[model samples]
Target: MRQLKIAVVMLLIGGLLTTAAFFLAFYTAEVQRFGTVTLSEEIDSAYPLVGVSNEGLQYERPWFSQKIFYFHVPVAEASFLVLILSAFFGVRFLTTRRKEYDTKSRIAMETALTFVALTMITGVLWTKASWGVWWDWEPRLTTYFIMMLLMVAYFVLRNSIEDEERRAVYAAAFAVIAAIDAPISFFITRLIPSQHPVVFKSGFATSNLLPFILAQVGMLMIGYAIYVMRMSEERMRERLEVAKEALED
Candidate 1:
């Protein structure tokens, strides 16, 4: 019950922070501008070009798409964080041989999977909008793809093993390795850059930062809430198993 209350409180905080972040992103952040435009010749005067020099047209994000950056970045970060948690729990399970550890690891992995999916989706969208491509073999994209595969493999390996104890051990080993590999993949991807720039230097404006931070805090809270809820459920299930064993005796 105490754990449940803690989970609920964290969840509430996460929700409020997320809400605040949303408002900050939309209302407070300065609208990102590409560049200024001048009164041009015969072409469409309303739209501003990247290098074209124009003195008249106002420069602004052709769409509100830039706003997505705040949410996207935070979510991506959260995904990696959750993935790390999964790996940590995996290690704990392997060392302790505790069912609770396995349960926690699985729950964390599930949350990580969801966040990673979100990151991929948002990343694709951002690429299309900002880079003019639906997909590219950029370092970040490639690394994230591999991370996704590793996550999938983790589950597959778990499913194939019939014995619960063996399954947990195998999953723990895989999770640890996968977790180690994810950052390596990310780092290596950056080292061998393609057309994509190695670093994006566009610093967020104050307004944007507020919402971005809020979203991050909120997302993290939600992630914790999910883990706690899943932990509680697993605990209950364990209790039932114990009860069944008693009945048989």
Candidate 2:
């Protein structure tokens, strides 16, 4: 119960920080120009472009589309972190053959799935804004999609089997296998040519950096809070099941 209260407090703090980051991203962060569009003659445009001089007109891009970055990157990073956590517990379960480890692995995978879905949704929005496409078969995008499917398959694999111990072993093995793709998905952008921006290679300006860092930290806190809360709920459910069985006996 004390842990649950701490989780709630963390969740509230995370929500506040994430909200602050969102506002800072839109209001405080400097607007970045996408690229300079040079034109020989002046033309009517809807976009907020600067430099209307007759000598080679240059247009400045708006910050409308790029605002998604603040939310998208953090969610994507959180997803990968949770996926690795699930894999870690899965390995532990395999080594010890413990029910608690299996429960932890399953819950972590569930949280990973939620974040993965958010990442994909935001990725699609970012792609459409930047590339004018809702979906693309780009290396990073494709690899992440495959990872999501593998996560979905993990639950399916668990539910299909009748034997409890066998299901845990098989699911644990599958989770470890699924986790192999997470690193591939993350590093694929660095390893190959992709439309996605590499944050590590390309540094962020101070204005953007603060909000990004805040969002990242807040998101991780929220993820941990969620994991803790879910684990508590699972334990409570297990206890109820045990009490019911005892009453029946």
Candidate 3:
């Protein structure tokens, strides 16, 4: 009962924060000028690099799209954090053979999958608007793509196994490897050069900071709420199973 009450309070807080973040992002944050390009009929003329031109060829992004960054970055960060949690619980389950750890791992992974999907969708849109491409093999993007694939593989492995214990063991092993692989992918992606221009440099303006921070805190709270709710459901199911087993005996 206490846990349930705590979960309910968290859900309410998370909902409020999320709503506040949404309004902040939409209403605040300075409009960022991405870059400039010439629209002249000189088809082969070299264009001046961004931030170097004195001409008025540059244009600022739509306020709505710029605001998307606040939400997108937070969700992306939360997804990675949740993936790490999934791997941690996976390791715990393998070492202790505890059903509770498995339950936690599974729920964390599910939450991660949900966030990852959102990250991918928002990332693609950001890419399109910023890079003029629907997709690019950029470092951050590529690492996330691989992360998403590893998540799918984790579920595939779980579905293939028949025995509960064996499934838990196999999934745990894969989770560890996947967790390790995610950082490696990130490193390799950053190491490689790409045409995509990096935005959101260090030392963001005060206008941008508020929305970004609010979005991040809100997303994290929501992620925690989702995890707790799922965990409660799993616990209830486990309790029901125990009750059924005792009755059968």
lDDT of each: 0.78, 0.91, 0.78
Candidate 3, overall lDDT?
Answer: 0.78
Residue 111 deviation, candidate 1, in Å? 1.2
Q: What TM-score number comes out for model 2?
A: 0.91
Worst 10 residues of 1 by lDDT: 52-61
Quote the lDDT for 202 in model 2.
79
**Better candidate number, 1 or 3, judged by lDDT:** 1
TM-score of each model, in listed order? 0.83, 0.91, 0.84
Candidate order by lDDT, decreasing, is 2, 1, 3
Leading candidate by TM-score: 2
Candidate 2 per-residue lDDT over residues 16-115, each given as its tens digit: 9999999999888977667566678667865545776666877765647788989999999999999999999999999999999999999999999999
Task: Give residue 226's lDDT in candidate 1 (0 to 100).
Answer: 78
Model 2 misplaced regions, further than 4 Å: 36-58
Q: Can you list the residue pairs that collide in candidate 3?
A: none
**Residue by residue across 133-198, what tens digits does model 1's lDDT show?**
999886677777888899999999988999999999999888887788667654664567455433
What TM-score does model 3 achieve against the real structure? 0.84
